[model samples]
Target: MKKIWAPWRMEYILHVDDSVKCIFCEKKQYVLKETQHAMVMLNLFPYNPGHLMVAPKRHVANLEDLTDEELKEIMALTQKSVKVLKEIANPDGFNIGINIGRVAGAGFEGHIHIHVVPRWNGDTNFMPIIGETKVIPEGIEKTFKKLKPYFE
Candidate 1:
């Protein structure tokens, strides 16, 4: 019997960084027109590569707490991100979401987000069950290169 190891997860497991601050907010200034939170970038650690998180300029926790304008921006940004991600990643499909809390897997649960992820057939597999990991065939930097041009 043999086992298949996912290369992408190695960087995730071996990779470490200064995560004390909100990376989304920090990376925001690099992007144009999308505002601070609307700034979409490649996920450093992605589910299947080309996974992105879209947020609001002002950070807020719960969805109900979001102002109508904030919600509008978030949605609009999400839609745009989906299109950009599709153009860049060219996956078979996507999985967009917002995890409200730690239990829901927000990571930064206090900051609300809309995830725009590119999905392909058979992406969902036993990696979680078998290896306690998620397999991503590509690297984050590559995804970033594919997506960065769209930030303008």
Candidate 2:
């Protein structure tokens, strides 16, 4: 049997604790950039390399709950994230969207955030298509360091 190794996910698998604080709320320490209404941070489990999320600081579950200001700020920060990704990773393309509820694949259903995933021409392969696994080239801390300066 072939094994797909993504040892980072072990934390989520082993700690199954429901008492953990809301990610968007408790993620202040992990924030790369912040505006009054929103923040940008690296996704702990990414769909692709340099995948990051833009989340409203207000902690609303549904996108409809976002204030006009929050909406504007989230979009603005997303654009900035793209710029940072371009400069740091030079990805060929991008995929940006939000998952509002659990059925929509939101791991954190209580917070609304936009996922900005950087993509390259051959980034997708049988590893994901057949094996159902994603391969991230760099560690999150490395990605965080590479992206941190741009937000500052």
Candidate 3:
């Protein structure tokens, strides 16, 4: 028998066991930057080397649900993570966003958070055009090193 490999769809299948919730919540409970779910941890797969996601502790699906303090913390942490990403990946650009609902492309539709993704020149190519696939060029742990300091 033979098996098929799908690098992108793997996201639907592979993930940290306890990481389905807000990552920031996990960090608040444990060490600051220790494990895979640390504040600066990388995407289970990443679009670029320093791409990072910073979320809050409590799970609030709606962006409007965030308190003033949570908003402040989110901004501050995002600033920190961006700084680290610049140092580590030195990307040519960035795309930061929050996907509020399923239509907005939030994989975890019940959890709300922001995505800070570093972009390089021509990261996408014929694969996306011809094959309808995305190629994430960096490893998760490597992204962690680049963006970890912002959390600490």
Angstrom error at residue 143, model 1? 0.9
lDDT of 2: 0.82
lDDT of 2 by residue, 27-74 (tens): 455589989999998888787878899999997898788999999999
Give the TM-score comparing model 2 with the true structure, all chains together.
0.85
lDDT string, candidate 1, 116-146, tens digits:
7788887877876576777678776666666
Top TM-score prediction, candidate number: 2
- By TM-score, the candidates rank as 2, 1, 3
Tell me which of candidates 1 and 3 scores higher on TM-score.
1
Which stretches of model 3 miss by more than 4 angstroms? 1-40, 149-151
Evaluate model 1: give its TM-score: 0.74
Clashes of 1: 0
Q: Where does candidate 1 stray beyond 4 Å?
A: 1-21, 26-33
Work out the TM-score per prediction: 0.74, 0.85, 0.71
- The C-alpha stretches of model 2 lying farther than 4 A from their native spots are 1-17
For residues 39-146, could you state the per-residue lDDT of candidate 3 as single tens digits? 434555455566566676567788888777777777776777677767766878888998787655666666677788887787766785568687666565554554
